[model samples]
Target: MARLLALLGSINIGGNRVKMADLKAAFADEGFGDVQTVAASGNAILSDDREPVFIETQLERILADRFGFKSCVMVRTRDEVARAVADNPFHGEGPQHGSDKMVHSIFLSQQPQQSAFDDLLELHKSKGSERLALGTRVLYLDYVYRVGVSDLSNKFLERKLGVKGTARNMNSLKNILSKMDAE
Candidate 1:
């Protein structure tokens, strides 16, 4: 069985709450084993023999039906997550003016168009101190100063990319990978 990481959107925020137990149950009902939630923000790891895209679509449907709400799910394999961590452009760079938690990876449900990527780059250029890098389907952000407040916020990313996604801080991503390994 292949290990998969599911990045679920529109959950556990803004009054839309689903317990980790219920989330795990949903995956288990779908025939996934070793199902676990990395954090309260809809990050889950599971092992399955199906394709990642199929898993994502099925999970989205299951979540919508089960919770009476729509969720955009993005599924990635173990190696994919590893590669994303390895390819972080800010890894070797010196510490930012703020905490490491300021670094974030926005996992996109689908790869954004080149034009969208260009648009984001343009926005980054206008906003000094904030850096942006594009990965396989992830966008890395290094916010030097504004950790909680910035124009390059999660909503800004979704609007700029024209795709559904979930943002995880660098620390959160590392923890998710560690949990995946333990399972």
Candidate 2:
């Protein structure tokens, strides 16, 4: 079975607190092999040969049934994640971007259209100092400042893009990718 990463949304935040151990157990109970939770932020790596789409739906159901909250799970293959990292334009390659904590990859549920991306930028130009770039089922975000003070949010992004997604900082993503490769 191939190992994959599940980037879960709305986890450990906004009153949807989920213990990492319980989250792992939920996946294991659902028959996902080598279930492991990372960063306590709902990133899970598990071995399964099933399609990502099927796994996503199944995980969403599991979260609702086990934790009483709905979530969007973005399952990505190892290569897909590596590509996401490399595709990121603001990966601390220069002084123009913020630190790794400010750089994030929003794992989108579906590929957004070019027009949607344009509209998203147009709507967000005055909102903050963040920079955005569209990628393969991913939205690259660079918060020029602290995330806590930012006005941008998951709800706003979902509403503008019309798709569900989960955001992870570059540091967390790299740590998860390292663990994923070690196994």
Candidate 3:
């Protein structure tokens, strides 16, 4: 079975409160092995034989039926997770600087067109210190400030790029990667 990472949005926040134990239980009951949540951040690392797309769909259904809210669950292979970290423009270890806590890896539900990506960049050119970079099925963001108060938000990105996404900061991602590796 391939170990997959499911980045879920709005868990323990936005009124979609869900205990990690409950969430893990739901996934485990659905036959997902090694069902583990990464630091209560709505990130689930599990072993499953289903295809990534199928796993994403199944996770969405499980969340809705069992947890009572809809979420865009980005299920990626372990390699994809590594690529996301390696390819990120703001890993805080490179010239493209950003706070590890402020830098985010946004897992896109669908690939955004180059035109849309361009448009987004153009629109937000003067937004703030937040930097942006496009990745394979991912959008990297260096918030450069508090995300809650930033003009660049998930909703804004979704509208501009025409795809839903979920984000995890650089630190969280590294921790998630470490756990995935150990498994």
Tens digits of per-residue lDDT for model 3, 91-156 = 874334545888889999989999999998898898777789999899998887678888888988
- How many times do residue backbones clash in model 1? 0
**Tens digit of per-residue lDDT, candidate 2, span 1-183:** 999999999898888999999999989999999998898889999999999999999999999999999999999999999988889998884234545888889999999888988998998888788889999999998876767887778788888888888998888989999999999
Backbone steric clashes in candidate 2, count: 0
Give the best candidate by lDDT.
2
Pairs in clash, predicted candidate 1: none
**TM-score, structure 1 vs. true:** 0.90
Q: Positional deviation of 174 in candidate 3, in angstroms?
A: 0.3
Off by over 4 Å in 2: 93-98
In candidate 2 the C-alpha lDDT for residue 10 amounts to 89
Misplaced by over 4 Å in model 3 are 93-98
Worst lDDT run of 10 residues, candidate 2, spans: 92-101
